[model samples]
Target: MKKILVVFLVIFAGAVQAQEVLQAGFKLLENGQFAEGAAFFKHYLTTQDATNKTALLCYGRGTGLSGNVTEAKEVFGKLLQRYPGDFEISLNAAEALMWCKEYAEAKRYYEKLLTEKPNDFAANLGYANALASLFEYEKALVFTEKALQIQPSNDNAKLSRKYARLGLADYFVKNQDYHRAAPLLESILSENATDKEALFAKAQLYIQLERYNEAEKIYQQLLQLTHGQTEVYLNLSYLSFLQANKPLAFEYANKAVESTATQPQKYLTARLGRITALGWNGKFKQAFAELDSLDSVFPNNNDLLIKRAGLSIWNKEFAHSVSLFKKSLRNVPSSFDGNLGVADALFAQELDDESKKYVLKTLEYYPNQKDAKDFLAKLALRHAPALTTHNFISSDKGGNASKNYQANVAFDVATALRFNVGYRRREVSNSLENNSANVQTMTAGLRWRVKPFWLITGAINVTKLEKDGAVAPFKTFDIASEFRLNKFQTLELRHNSDVQSFTAGLVGNQLSFKNYIATYNLSTPFKVGVYSQYYYTKNSDGNTRNLLFASLYYDLKATPVVKFGINYQRMTFEKRMSRVYFSPFLFRSYEVFGVSENLNVPKQKFLYQVSVAGGMQRIEDEAYQATYRASLTLGYKPSANIELTAYSLYSNSATSSVVGYSYSETGIKAKWILLKKQQY
Candidate 1:
């Protein structure tokens, strides 16, 4: 009887100790101290059965939520293995694997759990997350919906659904179905305005659409949230560069570089931004120097190699660009940018046949590549009889700030014969009068390649300028003979009976000048060219004028991507041209110096040009005015065949022609290829 009493006492003590440990763990978890609770649960489990359901549940939940995912996965995995029939253990293990990105195994456990409790919200959310990670969006969404129905206020269920939608959106983005991706992202943002991933995605889409204002707003929001995200700053810098705000571009790029010290990937991307900003700012040597250092640091970085190739292309170093692109391809053979770079570099060298395969390859990867498609359209016109059409807003000029929108269609009936038709609408605004005038010009033309290397093209434009109680009728005729000296050289002589253009923010046809122009362009194997033009004009009063322009251009080794030129003119005007606009070209003779550069931002589907010209303008008889002008133009191509360009020009003495006073002009031009002939 005494021995029995001692045994009962021992059993009671053991039971009390087990209760104490369990209560301690539970109490620790109640205070949300997961690490401490997990340790207590682990200690309690060591003194009990390995498959104790209550102990396993406490241990797994505590371990998983304590940020110990790997060890938690091991604990839950062992629990499931030992207690194969335990429903709770299986569910936690499945979620643990899902969090750990072991999707296949997670799905297996989830399947087992679902067969037992089909409508369990936790099971459904975990399964949906696993499926979404595995790219099974459709299945994921079904499970997510079920989870939400079971627990409408569950944050995890909502997040699971969001992830599933994002998975589909990602697929749509890859397929170039931005229309589909857009609403998905917008929906997510509407639900959670502070969602960083959704905001970043939205910002990127805005950038792609060339909506800089909207993109800037989004990026600024992101920046306010966290100053440490370097990519956001880098992208802002690129945006500033695109808008010709070089100072802001440099600032943001520098910020991007300084924002991170430990993240290698962000450092490399920020370095790319710095290089691009410097190049745009005309600091090519500095940009190239940075490139060399970046290359040494991130030697096998495909993006670095591709960026170098693109920079080379901008510099007009075609062969060097090709070499860099090849090196990039060696790292990523299927790289879309690498293939496109090779094609563009080859095209710049006038190697059409060799570039064809690369263009085709680019199309294979991204069929919507605008540059490649435009090049292909040009190629089709070159090699076979094809039809092509273009609508370009082209450029803007003057104090009145004239805008010309021209659309043209051409049909190559044969290799030697082509017919073309076009329409142009010109708008001019008078700021002082607060009035606007429009001119409608209808045009038709033809091209006849009389010789294999020689061609003649002629066009006639009938202009009807209707404004404030005045309807003026005018006819302009232009004809040109193009002599293709060799594959990459051309000499053209053009005559214009009356051609309309803008001068000093005013009407170019105010005097309807007759122009005789000769242009000669020569490209050498060294990949540079000389472009020279000489023109003589006689105004309506029959007084003649002479103008000469000469420039050395780099087609394929141009650093800073510029063409610098000098112009000299000797003109005695028979009469002063017009009323609303002003001109500094008042004297008989003038000399001007200028530089221009066009840049196509790599991978951005955007092109922009910046020009600065300064000269001595003869305003009064024997009187000279010091004049300077600047212009910025940005363009976007939505597809291979469609392009839109917006431009702003400012000149006191710049964009179209030097003037006596400050003039600002802004306009938009849209171009579309209505017809393309494919040799293939």
Candidate 2:
């Protein structure tokens, strides 16, 4: 019985081998004669057991190649289950599954082979392709890179990488990230300059960005490289139509249809371009004829339908445009262009509700549509009244004199100019001083946004002062430019030279001081900065003194809203009159530190910032002062045009005692933002 069993087993093995040869031949036949070969392979699979792995693989391939997807999937699955560890069989099964469009199963098998041997180039490439087909581009890129690394010379892997890159570019483009897509497309073109697809993508991007010159260059390059390919010709013709070059546009349109490319869509594009150019060039009848020809060729094409609707709308044929829009919507019910065209036609026909319905529908389909957004904004603004508000206050006080206040209403005429006129009052409290004054001042200024980093300002202040003894009148002219280096740095240069004559208690004292200072400052939290100023001052004694000053500061933010800063300053005078004093009249050194917290309020307003500062100053060894100062400022915004500010400053100095003089004053102030503008 053992001998008989051995002979039977050998006979079965021979039969299996013979069947495998027959199956391989059948697969070859399927490659050459698909119909008859598929019949033979199917008949053999039914009659003979396909336990032979190679035979089963051959049967799977034959069925897959012959378009018998369901049968091919079944056979591949059986082969995988029976020969789980066979890499060749698994790869073939995966390929068969891919042909069947069973991507998930194909990916599973490919991943299995890859897991066993990651450097399996064929498995890696196949897996990546499967992932790309499923639109999993980012994951596909990883495997595609692996495949290229394993076999750098593989053209298939290189092409797969190109597709992956193009996929990523398209993804970014769909998300409106044009900046990201631009570099990827450029890299692809660098690798293959004549890549017509990448060139076309670049042209489309340029068109969307309104970069007509760049778009024209790319379209011309594509036309030359592709030898007047129909798509390229159509692109060029459309661009010419946009530029109103009728003759050139019609020539390119003719060339597009004359090309050997067989795509019907290319012919339709050519027809549309030619018709649009003819209509724009005043050959209306000819343009209509071209549309009729397109209708004859593709009666159901929705794009052509929409194009006809647009032409009707442009020609003021409201009824015709409406009919075309409705017909197009039968095929594409949610078409963005069709809905927008219907809305426009209804609006032109005075169908308000219908127009709004279609417009809202268009926006529902394409929420980011620019035309729809603009239309909605304009409609909203039509029913709302624009509001304007303005308020301002100004106050000043001099030592040993009465206080003055000015109230004004400001109006903004333009970004660069503002007009303000208000009432002013001045009074003294003590009867012995017997002082009263009143004057009205009109102030105006011009503020220009010279650039994103600079502002130019010029203002004039005319004032009238009255005292018990005499009357004093003065005018001041100031011009300044503020420079912004970055978020945290600023420099201001100003020229201010004014003359003022004072009266006694009622008229104030005759004291005059004139100076022009140019200052440079740099400010940043956690950064070291420097400030310098040079000024020339003339006192009532007719002595002119030149002052040079420099300060170094560093700021630290201990919390989000609290900032602390320390500064050191050195000042020098240029000349001294006393022969006993050979050195400069003023030599001062100072060091100070302070902390401030910023308060933010709603409606475009802010509040200050109470801070305490302490420092020391020395003047040429003649007098030294240790100082302590505290300040409180309140900022109020009555309107967008005005800010009212009031602050109190208190300081105690040791030098005041040594010099037989002490100075302390508190003041309130308000400023109006006459003009505010920004430029880039």
Candidate 3:
């Protein structure tokens, strides 16, 4: 009996020591030292009873939390087989399903567990987490609330709830249901004021709603919360981009790149942001260099390809842009940037038909996408029929006056062809000469695009002229062609045969002339431009003339575009006809001009242009005379399809058939689109 007591004490002490070790392992796990707890349990189970249930359970959980999910599942599997129907074992086994990423199976098991024990906090929280993992955010949110009700202060349950709300809000935002998404995010921030995900969602939603100021405030808040992190800086850059502040966008993007020195995933995203900002600021060389560096690190990435494609477009490399976008499409067939980018590049190349195909394809992947819809609308406008009318009256310093009325209708008969018709009526009078004339003309024209970059336009005109109680009818024709040499260069050749009718003396004399003109223009990305025109005229009165006009200009400001320029003109006649007209042996003029206009200002309802020029002109080797010219136009677009404009101009640059002529004209014009939507 004494020997039995000794063995009992020895066995009891050994059991107590094992219990202490198990408690120590459990305490480590409870303290969230997952790897340490897992190592402790691993060594304890090797020499101890392998069937120790409590120790095995703690071991499984510790291993799972320590990222050894596969081994955790194996341990839990054996435990469930050994102790079937034990609720604690069953719960841990179900949780092991989640750790193994078998979310669907875990969801089913948790649902069963919930039905058996509705109030069990662990089961409720586990089910919620499984639902969240499956992206069933609505159900996850419901179960998360249930878990919270059971254990109101459970931190894990609250965190699960926060993420579930984030997922739901993102879903709503994806569907453009801002009203529903806003409140969900606001609720999260209301509780946890510094929730990063919620703040980002809120800022993005604000951007979508075009509340840029609010979005900016949110970004500033995130910047403070993150303490100048890469992600917040990148988002701030995006927000600035949306506001059309390219400089600010580039500044923030630089900050984002500087915030991280390592090549992590976030760093990759930050680099992309910097590339985009550089592109926006027209720094293509730097953008391309950055892109190349990034590609060496992460080859064939869709994001990089998209950025490269965009930079190619900006650099006017349309074919390269198309190729790059196609590469991106090969990677992500449904990528919005790929489809829309191809559409834009093709459009830039003047392949409108092919462009329309990609535009429709973009809509196929993203229905009701605003940018795609807007592009379609713009295409429709190009194909739609339009009508415009101009009316003006003028009096010159030479006692010559005129009133003119013109109306034109243009319709796109085909993708590359447009048909146009116009009518004009003019009445001219000279008080000093005691002469008057009335001229009426009807014109029909066709503009054919011979190639994507070349166009040919021809027109025939029938005119009836009545001057000094005599009426004469005649016919005229014009043919012109234009070549878009490249993005920065253009050339045009034009020939027209018409009767001169601008002045009463010319109308009375019935002067007819044929004019041939060659025009060339060069535009530089540096905001400078050069335009030159050469004109050759043959007259029925057995006289010929040659003229040259050129202008060099620079854009001082882009928005409300302000420009300053110098103009030079020289003209010579084969035979002087000072008696019949103001035909001079030689004429020359030089001028300095300034122009300010807001016609290109986007979303501007009121448009205007104000131009003024002053110069000196010489006639027939005579002394130079001072000349002045000015023009103003104010326009209003009450609707998308209708525009009204009032304009006035005055120039003393010898623009009439009389010598030293000072000319002025004022007019109101109206343009109307027959339909906003294309019929065909």
Candidate 4:
């Protein structure tokens, strides 16, 4: 066979070239000129015996150096078959594969070579890198450790060990095992302060732990070292947002959004941070628009949907908020934000029965959540929470004789109802002697949620008045219907047969009036609110009056401490609206203009408010007096859910009387709210 003979001749020629290379002792290839070395080895292979071990070894090394690892492996395999146990040739083959970054193939040869030269430093280090590349850090560390023990002061061994630790740390981090990953990352940074990998890991670790100040410090260092880190910018922006620095948060978020990183997750984080900054700045419309855009980019992301739900809740769109929360729960059923948002939105909508279910669900996942606990407590009292009221009024005209005092307490009579009982004593007297009548009254009241959206309430009072040994007995009725449109909106219509009996400070020898009042309130947290009332009264002395009142408050989002508001009132008389025969009092017509200020100083558990009003009082048919009134309210919250408040009002003149006089009234309100634990 001619082909067999040609192979024999090639083998013979390779052996001759090997003899020549031995005489030359690799003069051309030994100088580290890899191109020339490859050419010289190829020239030797052209006519030499392919089975020549020396020439074959040189050829594999040359081909591997020339970046043809597969060909190099083939050349080495030929010689390895003939001399499979030769150290020099086998190591060359493994090293060639490693050079080409074929780590898995190189690991195989290294395994075989280790049996021959078990203590070889190069083999151990190479094997460690191979295992690390395969993400087998646990196994890789074993090899790295052995390499270090064999060569204690070797830089290559130390580098391999460090790499193994970094690889293992990355592994732990991916598994969310930050506690195990932290020490390894710190060890790397301790040796090299500028280790970017370790620094980034450490910074993220701090972020997860909520050690934000420390994270900020490391991120600053990272910025100086690496200018193109999108996540760092986004994280810093989030930190700014948490600190309530809206402008700074927006600035950093813009930087992250402008980054050129190709990672979609990086862009997602940046955009999320930007959205948060927008929300913090009170840019709800803009934030919602941007959220719509984010929805297109991340259609199924639970975090974005939860964020949208939170914004909806802030906007007082409870129905929409619940919808978004439900969608988010569809994807991540146990998400803390999603579940809690559902509970809160339901509570806001006055759907406490449904809210209770979700609140318990939230507590199942997050047992120590304050919001859930607080909501549970409120849910327990939703149908009929307890209520208490106390009133003490003493006139400046006389002293304790012209005084009225009342106290009442109410609690749940049933799931959908409540009941209250109280008694009031009124003494009318002048500056000298007991010259006026005294009246005593006992009152009872009840409220019932007759339907999902309807509430009915009624009150009854029995009164007995004595003047000059003559006694008059009378009974009064008060009833109302309430419409609970949503958590933020309500409407009520009430009618009272004796308005003076219900008015805390009015202790006069005057005819009583039957009053009808319609009140509307739309209020929510961290928002502007409006309250309006239309009141009509008809007195026993054939007098009728009508009053329209409007009050509004705009609470600033950025500074929740301050609220700006105003109140406007107009009163119109149709007849002799007041009939205090013995006193110089007659209600004709009046109007009021008032400004209100509410303040809760930053970083304090105290709240305060002041309101001042000026009005024109029509005391006589053609006479009027300038009436001034002011009020102060102070509140101190000593602990969670407990509050103490004091309120005082001063009037420059009594606007409803023919005689102008000033009076002061003060009251205190204390509340102890307790959040209860609920079972899932």
Q: Which ten residues in a row have the lowest lDDT in candidate 4?
A: 1-10
Query: How high is the lDDT of residue 270 in model 1?
Result: 84
Question: By summed lDDT, which 10 consecutive residues of candidate 1 come out lowest?
Answer: 1-10
Model 3 per-residue lDDT tens digits across residues 219-253 = 89988888888988988898887777789999999
How many clashes in each candidate? 11, 5, 0, 7
2 versus 3: better lDDT goes to:
3
Angstrom error of the Cα, residue 164, model 4: value is: 19
Task: Residues 1-680, candidate 4: write the lDDT tens digits.
Answer: 00000000012345556486543425544454555666776776677655556667766766666667788788877777888677767667676666667778878988987887789776776777777777777898798888888888877666767777887876676555779989988888888998887788788777766677898899899888877688778778887765657799899988888884655557877887788777777678899999989888778888898888888887778888999999989988888889888988877766666777887898788665655776665566454334444454545442323466666666666656778787878766655444666789889999787775788999999988776777768789999999978767899999998734322224344457798999999886557789899988777767677777787876654343444566665666665423342122244434344444434433347877776766675544647767777788888877544557778777756542222346666767665433344421
What digit string (tens of lDDT, one per residue) describes model 1 on residues 231-259? 88988898887666888999999999988
Decreasing lDDT order of the candidates: 3, 1, 4, 2
Model 4, position 115, has a per-residue lDDT of: 83
lDDT of 2 by residue, 475-590 (tens): 76678888876545677787765543221332254334467777887654335667788777664446565666676655443222454455454444444533211134565546
lDDT of 4 at 360: 84
Better of 2 and 4 by lDDT: 4
Alpha-carbon lDDT, every model: 0.70, 0.63, 0.85, 0.69
Off by over 4 Å in 2: 1-52, 65-67, 84-97, 100-117, 260-266, 279-282, 293-303, 334-340, 343-680
Best lDDT goes to which candidate? 3
Determine which window of 10 residues in candidate 3 has minimal summed lDDT: 1-10
